[model samples]
Target: MAVRYIPYYPDTLEGQARLDNFVRTSRMLFYKDNNQVKTRIQRGMPLYEVTESETVGANPDGNIVMHGECLSTCAYLKDKGIEIDLVYIDPPFASGADYAKKIYVRRNPLVQKAINEAEQQLDNSDMQEFEEKMYGDIWDKEHYLNWMYENLMAIKSVMSDTASIYVHLDYHIGHYVKILMDEIFGEENFRNEIVWCYYGPGSPGMRNFNRKHDTIFWYSKSEDYQFNDKDIRIPHDAKTLDNFKKGLDGSGFISENYDLDQNGKIPEDWWEMAIAGRFPKDGVKRVDYATEKPWALLERIINASSNEGMLVADFFGGSGVAAAVAHKLGRKFVHNDVNINSIQTARDRLVSAGAEFTMMEVRDGVRLFRNPVQTMEKLVRLIPGLNTETNLDKRFWAGSIYDSQKGKMPVYLPNLMDSSSRVMDKTEMNHIIREALPDLGNDVKQIVVYYIDVEDIEELRQFIHDENTQTDIAIELRDLKQVLDDVVIEDKATWEMSQVQVELFTKWQIKMLTFHSDYVMKKIEAFNLIGDQQHQKKLANNKKSTFKPIKISDEGLECIEWLSVDCTNAQKDAPWHSDAEVKIDKTGTVTVNGTKTRNLWDATIQSDDKPLRLKVRNICGDEVLFVL
Candidate 1:
């Protein structure tokens, strides 16, 4: 009999101690009923469902774009018994860059006058809001690796046994992640480390080689996987073509008199492909996204790995290139990302490309309740004679509570933290308590720990007792529900408009429409509240200095960022025409109908009996479609 060995690295003594305790107490967290444990951990997280207005049910073989965390979204698919045939993920490279997009808002002359007058009255305190962040790639090395590990594990669970995956990365942490993928997919299953080389304009680095390529690690779930080499063949170079010999087959060339077509050879592991760049006049496949990949890059990957009608997924869908390419190639797709900007950009691009797909989102209202420290703070305010102190070392402690009878008791709280429904085990508890023990002093006799739900409390208590035989400390487990009795927080989103107003502009001989919505900016806060402390602080300063919250008004429109109108008369299968659009860029420049405007939009339209479809996207990418 042999045992398997797991590889891990802990840089410091404290990290090593945490790992030791984690391994020792891991058994106590294993539950017999896995579903029960999952339910408890996922109780307050949002449940993902398709939006009715965006559903394209008639197209059964179409694709999907889900706006949510990939981990939970993948688990949701697994529960539905939907297995993916191909996976291509271009996740964050941990490059420590803050990516943002310049969004434009359409403005009316009446609205501009009101805005100008209001600005003068306030002494220029108000500034226009426009730019929206996509997602941040900065992370601590350990945290980044762990985050990638959890997401990869969840993604693997939804992949078919015969499926292939392509993990894209850069120089920063690709080597570290290569080992992780080897462990998860197995060393024997490693397929190829494809190098994607590209040339772009940038400043020459004096200290190091100019980085111009990215690594794409390919792996398969099983030995038997789908591959189509002929579909991805390229044209041979002139030198290779000249070496071919005349073949017996008509107009064919061969190396040794065998019939072989003049078509190019198979591409090697190193590929030469240009990245997607801006060419507004040249009809190139380019969007305003900062990190968009060329369609050729994704097309090759999709064609070689999967067949028509197979499900292909890109969980880290940056600009929807994978979904767009997948749709064009007649393959089904599931595109997901945590950033709302990515969702909006993908939705617009796919719809414009005539992609029949439904839009979905995980209801995010339950997130505010899942924070342990916030919930504990509420509990302390509600309950008397319970004093709490903050611990700088521990991550999830609302601080230790001081009850007169219990003396100074250290309190521990567990949270969902991410999209996974996995509960914390005894090992994690031991690690947290061990770090906090020194601060509590050696004389402490008792400690209290609270959890939403656990597999076995007695087993955890026994494990803790066994580890601390030298000291007599009684470990007690408390249910978290005891603190959250009948408390509820209402959703902050509010709307004021009931209908859209369309008026005939007799002088311009066109229709003029006025859109109104106070709730347009309701979800703007979600984008700013992301990442660790440094990221959050950067977001806060950006919001404070560059933009201000739009004030709700009944007589004038506010907080609307982007608007598109579809004037197509056909009811079904008709392409969505961009009749008119308005947006505000990052520099406060307003543009309407592809022309710069003086803080206003000159919109004109023809009045028609056929219903007109309008899509209004707010600053945070939350959109609502209306028919008039």
Candidate 2:
């Protein structure tokens, strides 16, 4: 358990000490705080329920899609006593790398302005594209181990005794995680260290062999785990067939019988496949998500590990490939991700598969900023004079702002990663007054705290005043909503609905006319502002640089990443449902329902139900609902 007995154990003293420190800290994680997830679950946590009564077709309520962090979703499932037959998670590789999604501004060719500009040969190719950080895999080794440990334990608690878990990771941190998995699932239950091999063009200056394969450590919960070898058999190669024809067996490695099942031979632990969307000619369907995996890889894993109608889960759920494949193969699934963009992408992907599933959220309170990394990144831009470049980069302090009148005020942004930290009550106030404020040093005259919620303002003030006898540092509280309110704008779009008959079938059709995303335009404006400053500097200094600014046509339907119509009647204060939808990728490729087409949009969506509400998601994941 201490990781001392690993193969080829480091003999050096320093290596041994580092490993000791890691093991020490990792064991401490056993007692680490989970922020009262168990207590919350005892108040009736819901596990996923798939209407698994499948006979001949897909069941709409037989699958589940969740919008939540991995831990919270796992906790919900474990609390509900839901058991998974197989799990395939392609989690972050912890390589300290940041991945981003290409954001595009949509073009509406049907609009009058777009039509006239197109007839006049307005070059749409000059439109610039930008990327938004989807997630960051920057984690300290010990912290990454701790997080992974917690997640694996939670996942194991929800797995059946005969279930299998395939953790797909690259070369960066897979070795360390394998040790943790060994501890959690037991070393004897370890099945295979599958190597998924692929080829891609590398730089000419490359000095080493390209990391063309990813490691997938397959572990079973128990010895009785399912594995249908024939489900994923490959055909015998020509050389092997010839050798068998000549009455020569290739020794112990090859089976004695050349009649090794006429169907084919079982594939080896290593697989030669292709990455998703890398080669357009390879014909892999893609959603353009930053870290999506290929479908073929998942199909083989699912086919081998789980039978038809078994429940599978992917908590990371990037692009929902695992869940989608499970549903396609007649298996139930639960897909979860914390990011809204990921959830939306997965939702659209599942819909295209005609999957019948209910969308659920981990009820761990409302998220103001949602994720920690992006929250800090946005705070630098959201707050005008806030600076994070300070020696006081303590745990609670978000950053500091220098004011001539007030001196230095350390800003406090709620830890979005922790649910209990979102709301600032007397408990949080006490922690700040006693713990966080003392560390800020006497130089800090005021400690500014921004909170999403407070139990009672008067009570909090009284508690702060009563508890502030030790420190003279004043507490200035500000509502996070007030600071972030102006930044969140409701996007505007125009759409209409009509009854269209297709092949004598009564269908409700909705057409997207134009869309204006303040989120997209704000980023574009900020981008252009930087360009303007560069232009001014160049004019003054007489220099030149290549920086293209983003331009948009009047009708901005192209900004719409995915649009849907809730043909299911929208009752009073009822939740929205996606009945018919269309998605536009970065290259302006349009995907309607689940069908991909190179034809012009015609800007229409059709469904058997009547169109009641319209939902449009911008490229940056900001959504606005319109009542039809």
The best candidate by lDDT is: 2
lDDT of each: 0.60, 0.72
Q: For candidate 2, give the lDDT of residue 13.
A: 17
Whole-model lDDT, model 2? 0.72
Q: Per-residue lDDT for 261-313 in model 2, tens only?
A: 66789998999888862322423268768888888899899999999989999
In model 2, where is the ten-residue run with the lowest total lDDT?
Answer: 1-10
- Could you estimate the TM-score for every candidate? 0.62, 0.79
User: Best TM-score goes to which candidate?
Assistant: 2
- Candidate 1 wrong stretches, greater than 4 Å: 1-53, 103-133, 201-205, 245-260, 277-285, 363-365, 368-391, 394-417, 420-427, 440-558, 563-616, 622-628
Quote model 1's TM-score. Answer: 0.62
Q: What is the Cα-based lDDT of residue 135 in candidate 1?
A: 58
